[model samples]
Target: MTDLIAELDPTQWYRDGRGPRYKQLHRHIRGLVSSGDLAAEDQLPSEREIADRAQISRVTVRKAIAELVADGLIEQRHGAGSFVRASSNRFEQSLSSLVSFTENLQARGITSASRVLLKGLFRPTPTEAMVLGLSPHHQVARINRLRSGDGVPMALEYSSLPEDVLPRPDKIDLSLYELLRARGTAPTRAIQRVIAVNATAPVADLLDLAEGAAVLQIERTAYLASGRPIEFTSGIYRSDIYDFVSELRLD
Candidate 1:
């Protein structure tokens, strides 16, 4: 008698697989993990028990579990059983509206913090020229940071602005917009572009995502009241965590 039970879903891959039982089982479990039906830290059924239930050899179950572990989807402790890996959750702000990260998190009842990644004077590269409408000879201030809310990393932001705009990039605090306003450089409006992308190696490392995970990329060119570009920057956000919310009014 088969001791193991499966939620029989006809649409699941294993139902018509052309492989051995072990291979079929492996694919089935992975599908569940990817779909989030089996969540992180949720214990997988014991190998011995599952083998007995599925009427398969224990070696088959072990082979399947080994592959999942290698992919970082499951982990096995010395004594404890295997468990699914949990990915991070996310929060998102809009590219259409003007707001600070601190303010946005506060509105959501979550605390926000910043860890500065890069702060220095940078001469504009060719890419910056196209984005900011600046000459290659122009110098800008660069700031890279990991912005988090309620202690979870949300987005990786890299911004560049004319050096004359900030005066001292190192002295700036959490709210860049607030500082700009204090210095009489209010960014009245901005033009932004949005794209969906897969996180690169460095981004994945900082955002704690599995390599090549989906993310949203937003690039903005903020303008001063005089219609002069004040800042040009981009942000990468986790796809699972953030869903940009926008409201449209009919004319």
Candidate 2:
């Protein structure tokens, strides 16, 4: 494994001025995978070795490895270290690109259904005010739902929107994107922040998990084509059942 990794070009990261050193390192690893040099199920060089070889800090190596893991390109074992993961997970992502949840799931051949927990008007809290970019005392449409696929709970979606621009709660269906489209407020783009978290009581109950089970907490803000804020959502997803993936094109 070390010998295979040693063949990689060290100048790849410097040539690619896309982001920080960590992202560039990630792109370099991705390039190795694509070039057929890093075979399937191959174990990657240890962080210490990679750090020495790349002349970067071990912390940088760890950060690069984490991004690859998040993108589902690698998996770490207890005592064995990180290795290439199955390719199934890489194709399972539609993190952005403005597609409906139902559509994305159906395209992946997964069963997706929604249970509406709440759909009504509410005043935004300070946190929500910051997320939704709302006034201190502005009304917003609050939609809380449990999104499941293949009969397994995936996430608890907590969303908010400016009430003046949204329709009444009774008109909402399972697909919020569809409803948004019908109301002429479809989301054209979105920004997402994903983080690992431990489930609290309410989140555990919603996902049918034992307390403190790991979860992915994703915070998102969707926007319209005109750059108008459409919705702000905070989602807690079951880590065992869901993954977020994306391809970072490497030079």
> What TM-score, over all chains together, does every model reach?
0.66, 0.61
Report the error of model 1 at residue 179, Å.
0.7
Per-residue accuracy of model 2 over 1-251 as CA lDDT, tens digit each = 33545643466344443456776677557545544556669998788888888878999889989977875678999899998875724224557567766778888897889899998988889877876678977888888899987776678988888887674865777888888887788878899999988877577656755445577898889988888787898888766556678667789
For model 1, what is the C-alpha lDDT against the true structure? 0.74
lDDT of 2: 0.75
Give residue 141's error in model 1 in angstroms: 0.5
Instruction: For candidate 1, write residues 160-211 as lDDT tens digits.
Output: 9888887689987798888988889969899878898977757865765544
Q: How well does candidate 1 match the true structure in TM-score terms?
A: 0.66
Error of 1 at 209 (Å): 0.9
Q: Evaluate all candidate structures by whole-model CA lDDT and list the values in order.
A: 0.74, 0.75
User: Which stretches of candidate 1 lie above 4 Å from their native place?
Assistant: 1-92
Off by over 4 Å in 2: 1-91
